[model samples]
Target: MATKSDEDRASSYEPSSAGSDESHIPDVQNDCCNPLEETKYIVSESMLMELFNVCRRCQRLATPTVHQRVGTMVKIAAECEFCGFTWLWCSQPHVGSIPAGNIGLSASILFTGALPSKFLRVLRCIGVATLTQRTFSNHQASLLFPVVARVWDRQQRDYVTRAEDRGKPLVIGGDGRADSPGHCAKFGSYSTIDLEEGTVIDIQLVQVMISFQRTILCCTTMVL
Candidate 1:
């Protein structure tokens, strides 16, 4: 026969939520929030470029073969020479996932007074709508955007080198603008350009909270 104490001990061992109240739980508010990522389908250009040409497991060459094409957009399939592991790859500025290169390109275009909608519109006109602009925009905001300054600097250096090779002095120009129609806007920008080449050499931004003079002093700050 069980004693009263035994019954109490058994009840204590059973599940109880903070004096039998679920509300006391921390970290988990309602256990009803949906996950932000549904399915991970993103692949970068560098990754794809390397994926098909090398065996991930055996470290051997994976001879790439063309599998499909939608006009210039291609899907390159490969099988490893040693392990026989197979995978698919795509070209630069991915039609499936937005490439890191495109992140910088899109940013440069925006810096040059072009709207992001123009990129989307061009993609649509080309019949390459496998990827959405929103997805690329999100990627630019999250991942590739942080390193775009380095990319821009590299681009400028390369362009300068090319101009030097041409043995001609660069005809440079500059401009600045508010992001919106009115002066009371959240953001503004300043840019220097290679007028002869029609390429932006460098750009900078100024937040509304900061003074315009300070914008000149610390104006190398860029945005995406």
Candidate 2:
């Protein structure tokens, strides 16, 4: 015999149309971009909409204007002729953006991979047709910096606060290096180290010429 609780659950759990959709939900909640399937990816839709400027409600072409362009990544603004609804689109999706499109990574993964800067130019010049100068610059400023900052901040918080490291001596170390072979290069770097963990705590580029001691001092100041 069915229990009272079973009957209550049976009445409460009436299947709705959304229940069918539950099966269609992706295993991962946030899928960045699906390059294999164009219709399923939001970025592809946006790209197509930018190209066509279609009004979804009326099924007519809407007037599109250039809102912004980062590299070849042009963002278009458009409005529905009948409904007056407005929308925006980008020429290239974040996943479809350069480096990733050519090399296959979001901006976050590019710098972490530590692929040399020359590699990008080499790729573009040698007829790796997808890579471009603007894509490199755009990824550096827009995607790479912000992602790296967040990751660095998170690492500092997580590693420093670990129970093993706390109450022990703060064993810090650092090193500096020139961007190019020359000692008089415009770009150089200083990195703070967590000696206890054998990991780099932070890395910052020294934009101007400074004494060796001053550069070391900057790294020390950051970890402390």
Candidate 3:
């Protein structure tokens, strides 16, 4: 059910000159990039095509250019045949070089410690479009990991500094967990915690040896 306001909002897709030298066309709807007022809408393809098929300026059918789609983000450029005007519309906003959707999805997967391959498989199985594993890995290395690491280091420093500021000996506890029983385990994790403050201080992942063979396996295993 499309309302008059929604129909009117379609006109906001302003076109730039096809001959313009602008490498990027900014989305007017989300130009500010304000996090607090962020909003997301799941729009149907049919509805989107309905709005894009006609050139808002000339009120005539426009020829759409080759759609540039990156995972969940899509950019549509349409040129009005009559007026020779061109406009680019993006499905999601951009944060620097990466699309907001890509960043959000990648960050969510990393923060939650979810397995990217399995989680993305779930999305793909259910018809949800998302970034590929390679893209996720790239984002993790180039963007997500650095930020997360910096924040983690800062937090760890703060926790330790606060404990030291107390001018007393701190009680700490340490524990280790293995992925499997006996020598079959391929990985192990050790964690240190402040017993008095009930806060985790550090976590380290260690590779386990199996049957006198050095097998380097990278994975998180849950004993459930």
Candidate 4:
């Protein structure tokens, strides 16, 4: 009878030992072999449309100007009603302008040449692309655009080559007067391929033109 009792205790103790080992094993595995988890975010079309609407409203309120300096060459100036937020638009089909009312979109648009690379790097570091669906407050949008644009233009050359290779054509089209000075310009255009693909992926060209205003400021400041 004592032998039986001893056997039971030994068997029970054996499981405890195995359980302890199993617990410790997972910790060890986590230290060396744990797999990475991918984080993801969903972006809905409605959200994109809302962003577009806000941009349009803001542009109307801002009242920008457009004019041609030479034959077929034009420039646009966009300014904000609530702030000193200003940007320039140009008639270059290979480069588009940034949008108003937020930083990420404006930066992404103005700094198009550097966007693909820097944006991907930022997304990876954050472990996700959750920014796609995020809506920016008017103030946040105004502040964020210029900062991102500065960073983007700083490394513009490095990324331009890749952007060109990707067959992304920069096109801007708008309905504002071609030879008048105004604050807000209503326009829209998309890449030739993206438009051909039947994708509703048109970007705002007036915004791009507005964002370009920064280039003029930089040049003026340099001359001063």
Candidate 5:
């Protein structure tokens, strides 16, 4: 079982202002609310390569040509060794699971002009703590959605500019607004990417409304 410390208890994990208006939605609580400690589970690069060699030898011998079979069997016998209880397998999927680099959460907080440390701290706490839930409450979901939207928007702009530079017809889809405006009184947008030109050309925003009376006030722009 995980242990909680004084720091954990003292921490005030505030949800991001991006979704503050959605506060009428229920709060997301975790059974283990503390920040998780890092665990060392990955094998070193050199060791992983060595394990690959063993797998290759086993696979090579498992082939059934007579002349190569003897050589293959000998090689397999020599390399069929296990270093520890952990089994070695192809590293592609495993490597994909490991984060290549940090998201620079601390740097973002330091550079943001108006946001205070307390607020950033709260966001960081909530972001890291709720990572395992897979799904989030409406409020929690909205908190992180804008960040993703901004990134997507930037990438789309870059791709479109590149395509225009290449003198391509920037085909685009018409925007659609939902009939019912949600608590945010905003719409959801969708776009299709022109993979050949690496551009997002078709774009649409559809409005949606939530009838729930508990809906919170929607602000034009989020203030940190």
Candidate 6:
């Protein structure tokens, strides 16, 4: 049912570096903050081994060994059997002990508002190995969440300062949504936005018990 153009477009969305040695094993250096360093590739293990078959230093036949494989990250070493030359390669750059690939994937899942379990399931179904849910949760809690909190705090402070400097009341709107329909809802989020600025100014999450009204009151109090 698909036309050639449709297939081409679909294939274009695939990772450009898939199964390619040049992109799979980058020369990861101290420059981990490079945006290009964050790009991830899905590589075929067999094809990658071919590049390691000959030592770069000696041009002799070499044996490739996988030193470690952590989810999408792999550490490989090649040793020349004839000339005794050796070198190492890594599938991704590192942030201290944590692989950049793992952090990048975790951050993407959270930033895109994707449900972690379902997103991870799709990745596994496609045979693209990735960090597990536990690791994702840990990354969110330890690394991503703190960064988000700090940035959000700074943004909110800036907004408040700007509003005070303008010497005019902010034109704002507020709305609340329940997690589930009707009285059975146990959780809800209420958000406020600056209508003039067209930006969300605050979001408050609350747990519902006796009534949704009570949760709305809590959200309002926190926002205030």
The list of candidate 2 runs beyond 4 A from truth reads: 1-109, 112-131, 163-165, 178-180, 183-188, 206-224
**Ranking according to lDDT, highest score first:** 6, 3, 2, 1, 4, 5
Candidate 5 residue spans exceeding 4 A from truth: 1-135, 171-195, 206-224
Compare the candidates by lDDT and give the number of the best one: 6
Candidate no. 2 TM-score = 0.41
State the RMSD for candidate 4: 30.9
Order of candidate numbers by TM-score, starting with the best: 6, 3, 2, 1, 5, 4
Give each model's whole-structure lDDT.
0.52, 0.52, 0.65, 0.34, 0.32, 0.70
Q: Please, what are the lDDT tens digits per residue for candidate 2 over residues 48-146?
A: 556647786687867777665433234568887777878775444333223123223324236466554566555446543333444445545554565
Model 3 Cα lDDT, one tens digit per residue, 135-183: 7887777667767666666677678678768888767666666666555
Clashing pairs in 1: none
- Stronger candidate by lDDT (3 vs 4): 3
lDDT by residue (111-133, candidate 4, tens digit) is 45555446545654754322232
What value of lDDT does candidate 3 attain over all alpha carbons? 0.65
Q: Candidate 3 has which clashing residue pairs, if any?
A: none
- Using TM-score as the yardstick, the better of models 2 and 6 is 6
Supply candidate 1's per-residue lDDT for 137: 58
- Per-residue accuracy of model 6 over 140-204 as CA lDDT, tens digit each: 77668866876676677677777778787667777777656555466777777878988778786
Is 3 or 6 the stronger prediction by TM-score? Answer: 6
In model 3, the Cα lDDT at residue 61 comes to 81
Top model by TM-score, which number?
6
Task: Give me the displacement of residue 82 in model 6, in angstroms.
Answer: 1.1
Clash pairs, candidate 2, are none
For 105-178, candidate 5 gives per-residue lDDT tens digits of 22233346334446445644643221112223332243234444555555655654576577745443223333
